[model samples]
Target chain A: MSERSLIASASQTIGPFYAFALTTNTALGVMAQSGAIGERIELVVHVVDGESQSVADAMVELWQADASGKYQHPEDMQARNPDPAFSGFGRLGTNAEGEAAFTTVKPGRVAGPDGGLQAPHINVIVFARGVLLHLYTRIYFAGDPANKLDSVLAQVPEERRSTLLAYPDRKRRELWRFEIRLCGEGETVFFDW
Target chain B: MHSYKRTLPGTQPNRRHDAYRSTLLRNPRQPLIQIPQTLSELTGPLCGDNPIGESDNDLTCHFAEEPLGQRIHLSGRVLDEDGRPVRNTLVEIWQANAAGRYNHPVDQHPAPLDPNFIGSGRAMTDDEGEYRFVTIRPGSYPWGNHYNAWRPAHIHFSLFGPSLLTRLITQMYFPGDPLFDFDPIMQSIPDEDARRRLISRFDLETTVPERALGFKWDIVLRGSGATPFEDAGK
Candidate 1:
């Protein structure tokens, strides 16, 4: 911890050939172990570019609270009842069709910045070749009762709010499908700190 | 848990730079919305110190035989903009083999992939923010970016500092590479010095006599803004 000044290193694209190394262990993509609690859902994400074409090289990361609204992190000041079985972190790379899927328990309501209840949601970060900087966004359950009063969702425009929701697939009751558009119409709502 | 701070856009790469062909339709034209840094943004995975295996940092020792090409010792520190140590953070790296061929299925490059080398490694920074790895120098490879375009040999890096805002994924290059001039990705950074930071310097101190060469490159993540830099031009 010297007082020497150093500039933060700049970012570069991950390039097209990083899949073999970065995504070697796909087991990290599975969040819910056998005994994890809460509602089990299959989370599937499909990514598309402004050209309405699939982005096959993208990598998606998910971080969230366990079923009890407790994060498996030391920084979670109020996670007194953290779930030992839930790590709440997962990483997966998209396939040829620009799709990545995960099986995890749905998060519970957590306190917001104002100490109010927030909707159960998952924090998502996207990394891909040509994406100079990683993109930040969140996934909210479509038609959830908490969406009406969630703090973060309120920040997005009413019209674009639909972009954050994940609709239930027609055939599977516990399956949720989300679409992330990098640009053009119906672009996903990205957040910044 | 030290939080990240201060975003100086000029010092970073642009998201929508057009020289890179893939960014054309994948970059967002809409502005990012500001959000409160609550539990989600404030916290990250609580991976214990050095969760990686003992041999994980030594990419060259995976197979029974040694990997071909120049074996090098790559090491460095992880610091914040405030010059404070970012300790116990995970540092993951991936790169092309010595022959510039990847083990991936999609890489159609004619270069050969060393069976002994996997081209990826992981390590955790110590209490002093220092990390090290034993790997071979990756070779320069051609890409579809432009005619006769060759990318400077580089190792891809990924790290998750304490908080989500501190997370980063970047690259590390060799000292003097001719491809820097032609590669669109390396040219994407506007500032010359900032781009130069990506190039690791040859460090004789860390070099092994007959075992491996040594290179040093420090990664500075976004952190709280302090007194403005007095040495800007130099």
Candidate 2:
């Protein structure tokens, strides 16, 4: 079907709860156009089987600490410098190909829930069916020293910590691709919700 | 029923035989793209505070109602390509209680809660894509964001089609809701006319006038095109 027809058909059944937003470079809007930042970060989140195969059409919600470790959401929790411009919450559905990409500037250092400093990183949550019984998993950036001190990260067994961090990508300059493996043999270690 | 008969788009139907099939198999296509039209152009909130986990102060809606009325009956069908009915598709519905409060733990608002309003239900579409439910008319409640604001009487729907990408979430608003214009979520939709497509039409003949209005809503899911993620390594 044409894109128009597809959207028509899809929109017909979509309930009020589901809101579609672009997680691609478009989410950055003008911030992406600013050339001042060093190497643009390309985050590729693929919902796939345990073996790293793609699981398209999965819904992914990302909530991260802003530069000051504050979420822009109006929840009970508070942020130090909640940038009115930064929502800290991003929602996107994986394309038919099981991959969702976000072109965003790397997040800056923020205070951890405990008062210690947390390394600048993006937090990711992946939702899919095979893993339906469990709705989401957390994915983090690799090599940040804060990973060692972060309370949430420190709680997980060291052997399973790699499941949350993405491999460093040097070829695309600073573009980091985080392939989220939903299920299969090498399933990323998920936390107890 | 004879008075309800409408002519087919193409060949004149043989009124004597196969009239039903002819109507069913008509070229289910409309050349006229009726861009959605609506008299009330109200929109609702798109994104904001996560109301799901908010406090109790803002959670009260549908807290009171005389629990004596018969169950409100709602029935509908799910149609596929070629206008065939798909059976066993899971249908889920949630609405504000009669008092406009959802039976969720996170809601702490001062809205009333109807002990009678279950606020949630589930059913499977039959072979003919037909499904039915028993519920109550959810109440309209106030919100902190708007001045004298109220949400239209509506139900939140979630459908899990035979396929994964076919999953859909939508809302169904009743006709003649005075608060329809003041809702933020309804207004968030990009197009004003397209938004009306979400409202349900009233059927007075079947509805118990003194009781509740019968509304018919038919939802169409995407059936054609390469389902997304087919080419990727699965």
Local distance difference test, per candidate? 0.86, 0.49
- Runs of candidate 2 exceeding 4 Å displacement: A1-193, B1-71, B208-212, B226-234
What's model 1's TM-score? 0.94
Candidate 1 yields a Cα-based lDDT of: 0.86
lDDT of 1 at A27: 87
Give the TM-scores of the predictions, in the order they appear. 0.94, 0.42
For residues A38-141, what per-residue lDDT tens digits would candidate 1 score against the true structure?
A: 99999999999998999999999999999988887776777287776766888889999999999998999887877798999999999988898889999999
> Candidate 1 at residue A87, lDDT?
69
| DockQ for candidate 2 | 0.04
lDDT of 2 at A10: 19
In candidate 1, which residue ranges exceed 4 Å CA deviation? A1-5, B1-3, B224-234
Candidates in order: C-alpha RMSD to true structure:
4.3, 21.4
In model 2, how well does chain A match by TM-score?
A: 0.68
Q: List the residue pairs that clash in candidate 1.
A: none
